[model samples]
Target: MSNLRVAIIGCGSIAQNRHLLEYEENKYVDIVAVCDIVEERAMVTAEAFGAKSYTDYEELFSKEEVDAVSVCLPNYLHAPVSIAALEAGAHVLCEKPMATSREEADQMIETAERNGKKLMIAHNQRFVASHEKARKLIAAGELGKIYSFRTTFGHGGPEGWSADGENSWFFKKDQAFIGAMGDLGVHKADLLRHVLGEEFVDVAGFIENNAKSEITVDDNAVCILRSESGIVGTLTASWAYNAGEDNSTVIYGEKGMLRLEDDPSYSLIAQYTSGETVKYELGQIQSNDEGGQTNTGVIDHFVEAIVEDKKPLIDGEEGKRSLEVILAALESGETRKITQLAK
Candidate 1:
């Protein structure tokens, strides 16, 4: 196909703000349909993108001639929609965390294998230039032997940022499964794994509901990870920080330390034991309807993956690994003990 026809499931904020707008800038993609249980949302998104709209994703899958699809539904629906789309013969780009449970993630992976379709997860942080550079430096042994790290992704909450905030499906356990850990924590977990090139062997964690009392799921979480390589680290994710701190990651090694934060001025900073520090002024790549939005690199990666017939850096299995870390954290939080990763 000269150009791939695409469909989007779940016409929610992510579809409208990130994926749809990013796709608009890609020359090799033609959005053919948009599906959401809320017909108005689907219609609005379809109209905005000049595509057909449907309330039933299955109808869109059966009727639309799409080569790929972006599944932006809630956590619980991610695996099912992705599996269905893959089985229907379309490449899938599902949002993280991969799935609510490992069983569902395995099923999604199995379906992709059976259908021979690409199944990528939207672990967008992996596409950032600073993140890419950091990974390269780590891989090149620029930092020498690694020690420990700290990472965080937090905000006032998903309320104003989401279509309905606390009332949005994000707060619903049946729909979202896990709260902050799945929504934001998964990013750090995956990022740590990506940069460190290590698998987490165990985790201990805690969760709190200091905000968004309307939700039954966790609003804040903290976890410690012990990697198979013997490196250790901490990850924190919260939706209750009204002070509005964006995501940040810090890494320490025998020779130096690296920091990546959402500050508009300097997004990347590095300090060495030799009393030298480097700062990079990496700027935004896209505009958000509101503040603190990151970049469009992820959308470009998705398009490139389809055009080049290459697997995405954050494919389904990679995403599942991230989710496994967060799930281990949740289990640790509940049991108040270190949870071993089942591998």
Candidate 2:
């Protein structure tokens, strides 16, 4: 099979560390072009991938005969770029918090469907090895009747993660739309949905800008969420974890409880009601404090989905549903009331 020609739209940290490197390693892919508002970044990334460079995405779209494109731009640019690429007859792998609003997300999805193109949101946590294992166990009815859960994804701030550090678009409300809620919270929201195989019905959130004086968006947020089937949980997303990043989850079920990424040695630990304990040394979750991240298998899956003519694991609708949960959380926090999601 001929390799799919791919273009990367943002030459930032996510594109550099995740999308670009992964695509280069995938034998089924051939980098065709790279774009960024910063000419130097775009040129450097283009050189690394042996592809053409452009400062404007529209120019790249008009010029390159690409089979697929990765939209790694800021949150606000996600919908426009992805929709444009879909219109240009290429599949789009959009970075998550799919868009700033449900309206934007809905339009992107509609454009892809109208164009007969694929639209996959890059929710890499769903592809984690330990998460995959946990999902299978839950599906097999091992973690019987999940009663509650608490998940957290926190770090020092985007200053360490973004290419521009504290000055990145992530700190601007206009560009980022939401701060930790969009960056870290949405990830857990999506992961929980995938793991529990249920939809979030309502949420109550508390948000504040406890750190990072330069930004207009909140740096810390905590939320209580309930699933459609009555599973309750708390989600915390913060950029104030100045000590080190903590990416962990604990799920309590009638059978017992499961802890993920809570221990240094193991990635998953399960305790059954009958006193049977299983420790899975699958691997460790990547340490953002140490600038380490494991491959999330996003590129491979996106390519394979197109090549096999099948829908991606996280399609547009699935992404929209996950995004809705985050949006509702924001509304709940702003209104100071329990928010309900329409069935």
Candidate 3:
């Protein structure tokens, strides 16, 4: 098949690191156009990848013969941009947190359904080799009768990555909609759901601004989740962990436990009830690491799904699940009670 002509909206860090970089490596993809509110960022990214640049996504969508688009905008813009791209007949790979709210996520999914185009979320943890192995083991019941799990995603605040760091729209309620939960927590939430093959049905949470003195949005969040299949777990996301810990998840069950650590290497540690402990080092969790580039794994998967006419590993509905859990957590935190995922 010929290269899938692709346009990228929001030529931000994620677009630069994941989508653009991944497309550069995929012989089956050609970066066609790039759009960002800042035209210079778009132009620079486009020039780097031999593509066109646009300040307006609508203009890009109209003039480019694009087969797909990756939406890497802030959380609030995810659904609107994705819906527009899908309606324009482009398969969309949207960065997570899928949207600011569940209702918006539903609309994006519906648009993809109506257009019959692929809509995937850039939930790269699902593609991490260690996470994948753990998922397979869990599915195979190697972690027999899964009982509980704990997951965390924390880092020093987004000062260097985002344009304005602490002063950026990321900390603004109008622009970002939420903070740590939307930025990093969603990844862990999605990872948990994917690994266990379960949907969180209820959540109770505590969200706070314990650090980063200037931001109104949360910097720390802790949540308890109960899945539809009766699994229970805890998730903690923070931007205040000094020296910071990369994302990690520990799953425990009747027969054994699986530990996924994303740093130093994508290592999987298994401790069986039979007193046998095994370590499997998956090396790296991502596709490439050109200047802090994230796993191109998700982007490559999106390209393959479009080219091969196969469903992406994390489709529209699947993407929405994590956002649903986050929304539940947010509501639970506000109401000071457990909340259920919207039906």
Better of 2 and 3 by lDDT: 2
What are the Cα lDDT values of the candidates? 0.85, 0.91, 0.85
The clash count of every prediction, one per candidate, is 1, 0, 0
lDDT of 2 at 169: 93
Tell me the lDDT of model 3 at 170.
78
What TM-score would each prediction reach against the true structure? 0.96, 0.98, 0.95
Worst 10 residues of 3 by lDDT: 286-295
True-structure RMSD, every candidate: 1.7, 1.0, 2.0
Clashing pairs in 1: 159-165
lDDT of 2 by residue, 1-343 (tens): 7899999999998898889988988988999999999999999888888999999999998888999999999999999999999999999999998998889989999999999999999998888777888888888889888899999999889898789987999999999999999999999999999998999999998988978888999899999999999999999999999888889989899898889888888899998999999999987765665554566788899999999999999999999998999899889989999999887
Q: Could you tell which candidate, 1 or 2, scores higher by TM-score?
A: 2
lDDT of 3 by residue, 124-195 (tens): 888878888999999998978999999998877677566555577778778888899988899989999888
In candidate 2, stretches whose alpha carbon ends up further than 4 angstroms from where it belongs are 290-293
Q: Could you tell me the lDDT of residue 263 within candidate 3? A: 41
Which window of 10 residues has the lowest lDDT sum in candidate 2? 285-294
